[model samples]
Target chain A: MFFQILDILGTIAFAISGVLIALNKKMDPFGVLIIAFVTAVGGGSLRDVLIGIQPVSWMTNMTYVYVIFGATVFAVLFRNKLNYLRKSLFLFDTIGIGLYTVVGIEKGIVADLHPIICISLGTMTACFGGVIRDILCNEIPVIFRKEIYATACILGGLTYFLLREFMSDTNFVFVIAGIIVIVVRLLAVKFRISLPSLYKDKP
Target chain B: MFFQILDILGTIAFAISGVLIALNKKMDPFGVLIIAFVTAVGGGSLRDVLIGIQPVSWMTNMTYVYVIFGATVFAVLFRNKLNYLRKSLFLFDTIGIGLYTVVGIEKGIVADLHPIICISLGTMTACFGGVIRDILCNEIPVIFRKEIYATACILGGLTYFLLREFMSDTNFVFVIAGIIVIVVRLLAVKFRISLPSLYKDKP
Candidate 1:
């Protein structure tokens, strides 16, 4: 129940983020929806493929398409109104990361992979979609550049496992971990915090 | 033995395609290599995932990395000589489409899917990387706009199935079908031939 709700929210939030980025880049309606679709489900799609899931998650169900299309319409209509999204975009982005991380980890657990792989999948599902979206938009991925993005997912995933061990209530564990991730990501963005670039020779 | 040789040639050709595209885009040296790497392997990687292959082909072999890097260095040093690419690029690209189609179809066969899925995978493997590369470069995919792109793979794959049913020597089948695809694509390019666009609504 908790997961289903979080999954939908993550899709919406990620779609919104992608749409805004496309708008910022002056993309058309079709292009904006492509961005939104990739952002909302790219990582999970990749994960499902790696783990050998068939027909993929999104192709089987049309809800994700609806979400992306709805988000596209919303973004196109409200594009001018969203001009000031530059400042508060991180808040919505945080919720996306947190929710996607949980869903990815859960999917991994269901697949019965090793815990380490679960964490890796969780991190990827939380990050790579945005990376794909940004790259296709002709920009460096946000995770590669700023905001301690994947870091928040890793930490949150660890916290998820820890809470799972201590608290038998799966509902409470997921809720707490999800909130922690969102809060950490929010603070990271609020403070403009980021990791040191491995290749730090450039401005 | 034949598929192996074709696969290696296709990898090199795909890498060159990527390197040239990145250079044209004015990416830095590392950036160029990364783009080339992804472009060369992206279609196959995507194909593997869609069909539920594990570890991803590039990740498992690591040789794919070496192939992309080698091709990148060669392309970079000889950038000024790419006028010759207009001459040889067609041959290489056709060979790539032919080889990739075979490999994609084989993967689907291994996964026990239907003939339609095999054809789709073959086409995807042959064409999807270029689609991704063009999208990342912020251009509409050249294949989607240009002469004889996915059509080459579709025809080549059809030839493959026909040859497989009539003959058992894998090398003979791969080579014959490959030449057919290369000839078809080259003739089309020489004639400036193409299919109709689905999105063109103009009267």
Candidate 2:
């Protein structure tokens, strides 16, 4: 039940983020919708494809489509008012990534993939939507720019497996792992922590 | 025998294109290899996923991996000399997209999707590798701009269905359609034809 709510909320939050970017880019309405939809589901679709899941989760379920559509309308209509709720939206976006990481890890477990692959899947799911959004907006992906976003998901994925050894209940591990992701992301932002740039000076 | 040869040549051409872009971006060796691999197989993988084919085509076959690796090494080693062979490489790349459009349409037909959807799938397969390459290199996708590249693929896809009505042999349809794609693309480039920009100045 908790997971279900989180999933819908995440979809909405991500869609709104995409809409904001599209507006900033002065994209047409069709472009805005496309960006919003891709931002909401691109990561999950990529994960499904990588893990050999056919038809993908979203195509089978139409709720996400409706959520994205509604969120797109809401964001586009209230673009000017969005500044007032920026902080709240950011919180929801952070929470969405935390939940998304756990869900992606669970999907990887179901596929019986390796632990490292599972963690990578988790990070991809939690972050690739933003990557797609950035790509569509013609910017380098923030995740590739030393942001702590994907790293938080990786940490959460590791925490899930570590807790699995002592905890028999899956829900407990899921909740704790999600909390870990949220905490890591919050702390990283608070401390302005980031990865080092890979580019080096030629001379 | 024919199809296999086309596929390998296409892979080599796409990988080399990726290598050229990566070198231009001054990306490191690892980044160069990654871009090459993604450019060679990204389009087909996307088509497979959208049509519900699991694990994507490249993940199951190691041949693509080998081909991309070889192509990347060749391109990197001969970077300075590549200028001489640019025209030859362009021909191969054009042929690659021609074959790719037909392959993508066949996959869509096998899935029993709508004809329009199949055409879309065909165009996507022929163009999305470059889109992924541009995204990874941090730029607006060339296909989305004034390029006539995707339009040629769309025309090829339409030609496939048009030929299918009277043709009993699938291979004939495939070959004719592929040829149409190649011819259209070659002519467009030769004549310097391109789509007009959608963005316009406010009156």
Candidate 3:
């Protein structure tokens, strides 16, 4: 129940991030809605597709649609009031990643996929929405450029698996692991941590 | 044999389109490469995911990677001289859509999925890459906007299935249907044809 609440909050956070970027780009309202919707639901869409869920999550769940709509309106109208948007965007984005990582891993476990695939799914579910957001904003995806974006999620997912092995209390494991992801991401941003470019032939 | 050639041409055309957009966006060499890859392979990725293909198309075939690589290099070097890009792009993108419509439908048929899902896959395979490209370029997808994009492919797919049921000459049917998609898309662009906007929700 706590996780679900946090998950909705994360979705709202991501949606706000997307809408703010769209506003920065001076997109139309329809385009802004799309940006919010995609950013909020894109990662989970990929996860749902891979897990063979028909109708897609956003299609099946009206709650996500409402969250994105509400977030968009809030972000657009309260832009000045949310003066810390630039300062707090990363934090909200990181929180979303942490929540998504936990949910992704749990979903993968439920699907009975291999541990390796589960970790990959967790990382993907955590990072891909932001990736989609950055891409749609005509910028390189944050994860591909800054390894820290994905690194934090991977570490959290790994910790999740380890904790789940010993700590039978699932919610506790999720919360602690989520904190690990949020901390790692915040630290990475605070310290400007990133990966070295490997551009010998990558381009 | 024809489908193989068409697929290769479609990939090159799509990669070239991506390179053009990357150039317009003033992307770096790595950005160009990444966008090129995504534009060329994204539709197929969505198709594979939705249709539940194991390993995915690009993952299973290294040749697709080579095609994208070669095309990206060609596009970057010759972009200045490609005076006929707009028309050529429309042509090849249309051809890719037509071929993938058939390919996706066939795959779905083999998998014994419902006809509705198969049609959805076909449309996805034909249109989703361009959607990704436009989204990455910070625009609502061209397909979703105007000029008979997905609509053309969907119409062509319907024609192909109808022709397959009624016509005995498979090769002739394929050629005729491919031509119809290409011609429809060309005429749409030539005549400024487009779909009505569904974006008129409450502002």
Candidate 4:
């Protein structure tokens, strides 16, 4: 029940973010709605498809679709007022990623994927929606370029596996792991930390 | 047997194109190889996942992996000489999309999806590899901007369903559909046809 609420909140956060980006790109209403839908469900759908889940989770459950639609409408209507809620939006987004990371890791574990693969899946689920959004908007994905976003997911996934070995309560481990992801990202952003550049300065 | 050969050739074409792009970006060897692999199989993998196919096609068949690797190496070694083979590369790419479009349509048909959805699947299979490649290389997807590429696949997919109403031979239909895609794209390029812009002049 708790996770479900977070998932819905996450979907709302993702959908709103998609709307903001699409509006920024001056997309038509249909395009904005489509982008919002894709941002809300793309990662989870990708995860489900990868593990061979039929119809995907969103198709089987209508809640996410409705949530995304509602969020898009709300976001579009309140676009002008959204600046006042930026901090709230960021908090929701952070919590969304934290929840999504653990959710992806759990799905990978269910599929019996390797630990490394699970970590990858976790990071992918938490990050790829933004990646797709950026691609459609014709910008470099913030996660790939400067953010510590995916790294936080990876660390959380690693923590999930590590905690599993020591903790008997799986639910407790899940909550802890999710919190770890959220806290790490929050701290990283607050400290203005970033990953080292892969390329050196051109001579 | 013929389709399988074309599939291999298509993989090679896609992989070589990926290498060319990665080289242009001055990516290191690992980045180049990753791009080639993604370009060769990204579309098919996406299709498989959506249809709930486990392990994906490339994971089950090692042939694509070997082909992409070999193609990447060959393209890198002959990079300087590749300008002379641009026409050949273009032909191969055209053929690749043709085959991939038909293949995706077949998968969608087998899954008993709607014709409209099947057409979307076909277009996705034929064009998304390049879309993903451009996304990774931090550029707008060429198909979305200036090409008649995906339109050809959609047209071919429509032809498949239309021909199915009269044709008794399934293989013949497949071949015709593939040929339609190739011919449409060839004609579009030769005639400089393009999709009309959706946005009006700002001024």
Candidate 5:
């Protein structure tokens, strides 16, 4: 029940973020809605597909579709007021990634994948929605160029495996790992930490 | 047996195209190989996932991986000669889309999806490899902006259903539909046909 609530909140946060980006790009209403939908579900959908899950999670559950739709409409209606809520939105977004990363790791473990692959899946689940959004918007994925986004997920995934060696309580492990992801991202952003540039000089 | 051969050819074509684009972007060899791999299998992987096919075709079959790897190496080695082979490359790409679109439609039919959804699956399978490639390279998908690419796939998918109504031979229907996609693309390129711009003024 707690995870479900977090999932919904994550969906709302992702949908609103998508709305902000789409509106900034001057997309029409339909485009904005589509972007919001993809951003909310794209990462999880990708994870489900990779592991051979049928129909995907969102298709089986109507809650995500409704949440994304409601969030899109709400964000669009009060887009101007959103500037004031940036910090709140950022917090929600960070929490969303933390939850998503752990969720993905759990799914991978259930599928019996290797630990390395699980870590990759966790990072992908937390990051690929924004990647898809950036691709649609004709920009490089921000995670690929800057930000400690995927790195935090990777670290959290490592923490999950490392903590599991000594802990029998899976739920406790999940919470700690998720908290690690959230805390790492928060610290990274607060300190303005970013990935080092790949290029010798900016192209 | 025939479809297998065609699939390999398509993989090769897609991989080579990916290498070309990655080279143009001055990406490292590792990046180029990753792009080629995605461009070769990304579309079909997407289609399989949507329809709930387990392990996806590529994961179960190593043929695609080998073909893409070989194609990438061959394209990189003969980069200079690729210009002379542009027409040949274009032909292969057209054939690749033709095969991919039909393959996707067949998968959708097996899954008992609606005809409209099947058509969409076909278009996605035929075009999303390039979409992913473009995304990884940080550009708008060429198909979304211009090109009669997905249009050809959609028309071919329609042809598949339409022909199935009158024909008892499934192989014949596949051939005709694939030909339609190939022919439409060939004509579009020859005539420089494109989707009309959605924007009233250039942004």
Candidate 6:
């Protein structure tokens, strides 16, 4: 029940973020909805596809679609009122990633994938939606540019595996791992932490 | 026998295109190979995933990896000479899209999808590899811009269904549909045709 609530909250937060970006880009209504849908479900869709799951998670579950639609509509109707909620939006986004990372890692484990691959799946699940949104909006993905976003997910995945060796209680492991992701991400943003660029110019 | 040759040729063409872009971006060797791999199989991977196919096409087929590796090595070593073969590259790219579209449509048909969805699948299969490449390279996707690229695939898909009504030979229909896609794409580029941008600024 707790996880389910966190999942819905995360979906709503992600969808709203997508809607805001689409509106800022001056996209049409159809484009706005598409962006919101992709942002809310894109990561899990990619993970499911990679793991060979059929029809994807969203196609099998209609709740995600409805939630995205509602969030998009709400965002568009209350655009003016959203400005003051930046802090809350950030909080939701952080919490969403944290929960999503643990869920992703668990899914990868169920599939019996390698630990590194599981970590990658977790990171992609939490971050690739923003990557897709930025691509569609014709901008460099914010995560790829200079953010500790994916790194936090990676660290969280590692935490989950490490804790698994010590505790057999699944729920306890999940909560602690999720909290680690949230704290790490929040700290990174607070301190302006970033990964170094790999780009290079000609000799 | 004929389709096998076309498939290999298309993979090589797509891999080369990716290598050229990665080189232009001045990415590292690993990055170059990553781009090449994604460009060669990303579209088909996406199509298979959407249709509920597991393990994706590339993971099960090692041939694609080998082809991409060979193409990347050849492209990087012979980068300067490649500039003079722009005409050949263009021809290969056109033929690649044509073949890929037909294959994508066939996959969709086998999966028992609606005709419209099949056409979309075909267009996505033929074009989305480049879209992925552009996104990774941090540029506006060339297709989403003014290019006549995806339009050609859609037309080819339409032609395939239309030809199927009159012809009983599956191979004949495939050949004709592929040719239509190739000719349309070639003519569009030859005449500098483009779709108008939907963007509109406030007065």
Per-candidate TM equals: 0.58, 0.61, 0.57, 0.63, 0.62, 0.61
TM-score for the A-chain in each candidate structure: 0.87, 0.94, 0.88, 0.96, 0.96, 0.94
Provide the lDDT at B47 for model 2: 85
Candidate 4 chain A — worst ten consecutive residues by lDDT sum? A25-34
Interface RMSD values for all candidates: 6.0, 4.7, 6.0, 4.7, 4.6, 4.8
What's the C-alpha lDDT at position A167 in model 5? 99
lDDT (Cα, tens digit) per residue for candidate 2, span B1-203: 97899878988999999999999999999999999988888989888876688678989999999999999999999999999999989998999999889988988888877676677678778888988998899876666555568888889999899888998998888899999999999999999986543235521
DockQ-based ranking: 5, 4, 6, 2, 1, 3
**Model 5 lDDT tens row, B19-138:** 999877866555566689889888988888767786667655657767888898899888889999898888989999999999889889889999999999999998999998897898
Error of 5 at B154 (Å): 18
TM-score head-to-head 2 vs 4, winner: 4
Give the Å shift of residue A140 in candidate 4.
Answer: 6.6
Deviation in angstroms for B113 in model 3?
9.1
- Write down the TM-score for model 3: 0.57
Candidate 6 lDDT for residue A50: 77
Candidate 4, which segments miss by more than 4 Å at Cα? Answer: A1-37, A50-52, A57-131, A135-203
The most accurate candidate by lDDT is 5
Can you tell me which runs of candidate 1 are displaced by over 4 Å? Answer: A1-48, A51-127, A135-203, B1-3, B28-31, B191-203
**Candidate 3 vs candidate 6, TM-score winner:** 6
Candidate 2, TM-score vs. the true structure?
Answer: 0.61
Off by over 4 Å in 3: A85-89, A199-203, B1-44, B49-109, B112-203
Model 2 bad stretches (over 4 Å): A1-53, A57-131, A140-203, B201-203
lDDT of 3 by residue, B91-158 (tens): 78778877777677667778898767776777787788878877776777877655687777677667
Q: Write the per-residue lDDT of candidate 6 for residues B99-169, one digit (tens) a residue.
A: 99998999888877767667767887898898789878987566654567888888999999998999999
Greater-lDDT candidate between 4 and 5: 5
Docking class for model 6 is incorrect
